[model samples]
Target: MSQGPAPRVLSDEALSELLGGQQFGTLATNKRSGHPHLTTMLYKWDPEARVLRFSTTADRIKVKQLRRDPRAALHVSGGDVWSFAVAEGEAEVSEVTTVPGDSTGQELLAMVRGSVDPADEDAFLQQLVDERRVVIRLKVQRLYGTALDVNG
Candidate 1:
């Protein structure tokens, strides 16, 4: 087999940029049998918090797996040039709570306002609230990525 070129290490800034721009990735969670269960998901990166978060319903298998085993990995890849990154982290799942008596679903609103039409914001928020989504926060323990060329 022909060997490929050595992968160049990505810097913290580069990784953060790639992560923030990546809207989707595969989340790897451990099933009870210790096998990997992979789920393609949409994620939001919080650079300031240094964590990655994704929304999913409370009853999802990934949530159950995470609750049982907090250890997880998120593999994100981007760039037509073939760049990829893997973040190994511990996860914490929490039920999303809105302010009491605030029927607007603040968290959901913030997440969808950019994509949903302004006039439909309320309806979208309501739909999200009805889903009872839980936010899974991944506390990155180690982040490493490689690209064909970092400067590219």
Candidate 2:
């Protein structure tokens, strides 16, 4: 049985590039009572270090759920492009105390916004920061990404 991570058919660079499309995926975690909690999110598969990082509002049930438990799973897919990635790990919560430069700034900002509402995203973000929603970092232990062969 091919177990633990995915087959390394694609190189790290290819995998990273594949994951760079910013696919909106679902995240799942377990509660103390064994109930599963799931939330939609935007994520990136950092192939260099094989880390999956994502952002979410701290006040959300997902965040609260994480506080109760750290285990997490992410499902990422990018349309008909035939790319998908899955990751499992311990979600670490912290304040995103750093800002990005021009290149990454837009992406980072988009992530922050995507985590919340658009009507008052800034206020929501500020509230998130005030309420400490600044970061939703997940430290992955196991990950696997495969380029789905639709024809197969």
**Best of the candidates, TM-score:** 1
Instruction: Encode model 1's per-residue lDDT on 43-124: one tens digit a residue.
Output: 8888887888887887899999999999999999967556878888999987654442143356545555478788886666
TM-score of 2: 0.61
Taken over the whole model, the C-alpha lDDT of each candidate is 0.80, 0.62
Question: Model 2 over residues 1-152: C-alpha lDDT tens digits?
Answer: 74444333554455456566666778898877798877787676556665666655556777777888888888766455566666677887655433322323333455555655566655544543444434566776665676654443
Superposed by TM-score, candidate 2 places the C-alpha of residue 97 at a distance from the truth, in angstroms, of 7.3
The TM-score values for the models, in the order shown, are 0.83, 0.61
Q: Give the best candidate by lDDT.
A: 1
Error of 2 at 75 (Å): 0.5
- Which residues of candidate 1, in runs, are more than 4 Å off? 1-4, 96-105, 150-152
Q: Where does candidate 2 clash, by residue pair?
A: none
